[model samples]
Structure formats: structure tokens, C-alpha cells
Target: DQQVKQNSPSLSVQEGRISILNCDYTNSMFDYFLWYKKYPAEGPTFLISISSIKDKNEDGRFTVFLNKSAKHLSLHIVPSQPGDSAVYFCAASVIFSSGSARQLTFGSGTQLTVLP
Candidate 1:
């Protein structure tokens, strides 16, 4: 079973507009979440993240929000630019009692396109 899922396979936004990407998870055990942006010839790069304890986390133009009660999270990019177009992956992980984190479970990525 896919614990994490990005229901929308793709999203399109105009340059300088806000783009929102959403994700859902079935596993409540997950305590941490992250978003990764991947380009055609490069590996997925860490974009933003949030802890289950916090509802929102922001870094520059990227913001991640988590709704623990709903098992959902979303990434919002403001003033979307062409360079921001890429596949965005949502990943979740659980932290063990030993303070170590387990391997992340990733959702199928959502392709984001920014039109000029």
C-alpha cells in the first residue's frame, strides 16, 4: 500500500502566481515530512520540511504546511518562476526512540509547470 500519495499528477501555474502542491498520507506514525524538487538531469533536491508538531514552516518563497488531524500536507510557492518548474516529491518519515530517523517513504511526484 502506498502510504503517501500525491493525487494530482501535474499542476500548472503562471509565472509570478502562487502554486500549490498537495499530498496525503495514510500512516499516522509519520512524524516528519519533506518536499523535494527534481529536475530532468539532476537528483531531487531538498526544498522544505515540517515537523508534525508544527502546522507550518516557511523558507523564503517556499512554505510547507501540515495538518496532522487530516494527514495532509501542502507546499506553496509564491511568485512561481520558470526555474521552479520541476517534479515535487512529498516524503514522510518516523523518528525512532533512539533519535534516529527511518528511511523516508516517498509519494509519486507531482510535475509542476510554470508558464511565462
Candidate 2:
């Protein structure tokens, strides 16, 4: 079963507009959330993270919001740019094992397009 899900498989937006991506989780025990941006050849989800301890986290043109009661989270990109176009992945944190690096469970991916 997919404990976490991104209901929308893709999203598209024009330049300078706001783009929103949504996700839902079935596991109430999951306390940490993240959003990762991926390009054609690189690895890493771009490492966007938010702790369940907080309701929201923001950085530059990106922001993430969480609702523990709803088991929902969303990522918003403002003034979407063509340069921002890429696949975005949603991941949740699992309990860490000793000496293990942080890992993520990725969504299939969402393709964001910023039309000029």
C-alpha cells in the first residue's frame, strides 16, 4: 500500500503564476514531510523538508504546508519560471536506523511546466 500519495500526477502553470502541488498520507504516524525537485540527470529530490512539528516551511519561491489532522501537505511555487520546470517528488521520512543516511519514498513524479 502507498502510505503516502500525491493525488495529482502532474501540474502546469504559466510564467509568473502560482503553482500548487498536493499530497495526502494514510499513515498518521508519519511526522515528517518533504518535497523534492528533480532535473533530467541529477539525483536528490532537491531536499525540501518540513517537520510535522511545524505547520509550514518556506524558502525563496517555494513553500510547504502541513496539516497533521488532515494527513495532507502541499507545495507552492510562486512566480513560476521556465527554469523551474521539472519533475517534483513528494517523500516522507521514515524512522532512521543507526548510521543510515536519510532516505525517502518518492511519488511517481509530477511534471511542472512554466509557459513563457
Candidate 3:
């Protein structure tokens, strides 16, 4: 079974509108959650992130909300622009032991299209 899941395959929004993407996880040990944006023929670029200890984190037009009790997280984009079109991925990671490397587990990803 997949630890992380993004139920929506795609999303579309007009320019200057809001776009919302949802994700769910089955792993309770995951403490770090992140959102990444990927373009064709390019690597995923980190967008926003939130720790399990915090309910919400925001940066400019992007925001990430995490609900530990529900094992869910959501990414919100305000004033969505055409350039924001890309595949959005939800990832979660946990440190297994002290000074251990973090291994990120990614969701399938949701394609977001922003119309001008």
C-alpha cells in the first residue's frame, strides 16, 4: 500500500484564482511534509513545507497545512498564474534514528493547469 496518496489526478484554475491540492498519508511516523512543483523535462522544485508540530506554514502565495490527527495535508496557491502550471507532488519524510538521512516518500502527483 502507498504511504502517501494524492487522489486528484489533475486540477485547473483561471489566472488570479485560487488552487487547492489535497494529500493523505497512512504513515503516522512521518513528521516532515513538503510540496514540490515539477515541470516537463525538469526536476521537481521545492515549494512549501510543514512540520508535524505546526498546523500551517506559508510563503508568499503558497501555503501548506498539515493535520497530524487526520494524517492529511493540503497545499493552497493564491492568485494562481499561468506559470504556476505544473505537476504538484506531496512528499513526507521521517528520521528513523539519530543523525539518520531523511528519505522522502512521494505521492503520485497532481497536474495543475492555470489558464491565462
Worst 10 residues of 1 by lDDT: 94-103
Question: Per-residue lDDT tens digits of candidate 2, residues 28-96?
Answer: 766778888888998755647899999999999899999888988999999889998888888887665
Q: 1-116 in candidate 3: lDDT tens per residue?
A: 99999999999999999999999999998989999999999999999999899999999999998988899999999989999999999999987567578889999999999999
Error of 3 at 46 (Å): 0.8
**What TM-score number comes out for model 2?**
0.88
Q: In every candidate, how many clashes are there?
A: 0, 1, 0
Number of the predicted model whose TM-score against the real structure is largest: 3
Whole-model lDDT per candidate: 0.95, 0.83, 0.95
Off by over 4 Å in 3: 96-99
Which ranking of candidates, highest TM-score first? 3, 1, 2
Q: What is the lDDT of candidate 1?
A: 0.95
TM-score of 3: 0.95
Give the range of the ten consecutive residues with the poorest summed lDDT in model 2.
95-104
TM-score: the better of candidates 2 and 3: 3
TM-score result, candidate 1: 0.94
